[model samples]
Target: MPYSPEDKKRAVMRLRRIKGQAAALERAVEEGTDCKSLLQQIAALRGAANGLMAEVLDSHLRELFGSAKETVAVREARDPDEEIEALMKTLRTYLK
Candidate 1:
């Protein structure tokens, strides 16, 4: 589903933060920062990215099946099994 302007703004903010974190991570590795500090930054970045993913997934599910209404024609065109399996694969890859 396409995001509303507000949602798009929020997601963009998240992505920017993640980008900054990634750059910092690269610098840390290149400069051979202390192991503990590097691990902490890495963990924090991973958690932030995961949270963003969770929000996107939740929003999409809600739009498709929860409070928000989707077009019946569009909904009917999709196979439930295929959709479920696709979501499962995406979740697996995201979590992995």
Candidate 2:
């Protein structure tokens, strides 16, 4: 399902924050900031990215399984449990 207006707004806000973080990181590098501070900024950026990914992924999974228009044959052809397991594994790897 497509994002609701509020969801879109929130996602856009998050993306803007990520962009700001990226800009700050770039500025820090150009300014020759300390290694520890740069590493912290990098970690913060990664965490923000991961949070956004998880939010979108959750919405996608909900839409895939919760749609009323999904055909019986289509649903039967794909196992929700298996799909979820695979998604979980992928997420775990990505988070790491």
Candidate 3:
């Protein structure tokens, strides 16, 4: 399912923050920031990206399998257990 307006807004805000983090990292590099500080910035950027990915993944899963309001016919078209298992496998491989 597509993101609701609120979700889209939140995602845009997150992406903007990530863009800011990237810009900061670029500036740090140009200014020859210390390795420790650079590493910390990189880590923070990575965490933010991962967090955004996780939030979107959660939203997708909820739309696919957790919505109590979904029609019976819609629910019958997919196997939630199988979908979840596939998603888990993908996540495991991605995280590794």
Best by TM-score: 3
TM-score of every candidate relative to the true structure:
0.73, 0.72, 0.81
Q: Which window of ten consecutive residues has the lowest lDDT sum in model 1?
A: 62-71
For candidate 3, list the clashing residue pairs, or say none: none
In angstroms, give how far residue 65 of model 3 lies from its true place: 0.8
Off by over 4 Å in 1: 68-86
Judged by lDDT, which candidate is best? 3
Candidate 1 residue-wise lDDT at 23:
97
Model 1 lDDT tens row, 1-96: 337888888888888999999999999999999999999999989988987887799877766453536668877877889778877887788677
How much lDDT does each candidate structure score? 0.82, 0.85, 0.87
Every model's Cα RMSD, please?
3.1, 3.7, 2.2
Ranking by TM-score: 3, 1, 2
lDDT of 3 by residue, 18-77 (tens): 999999999999999999999999999999999788888888778657689878998899
**What shift in Å separates residue 32 of candidate 2 from its native position after superposition?**
0.3
Local lDDT at 95 for model 2: 67
Candidate 1 clash pair list: none
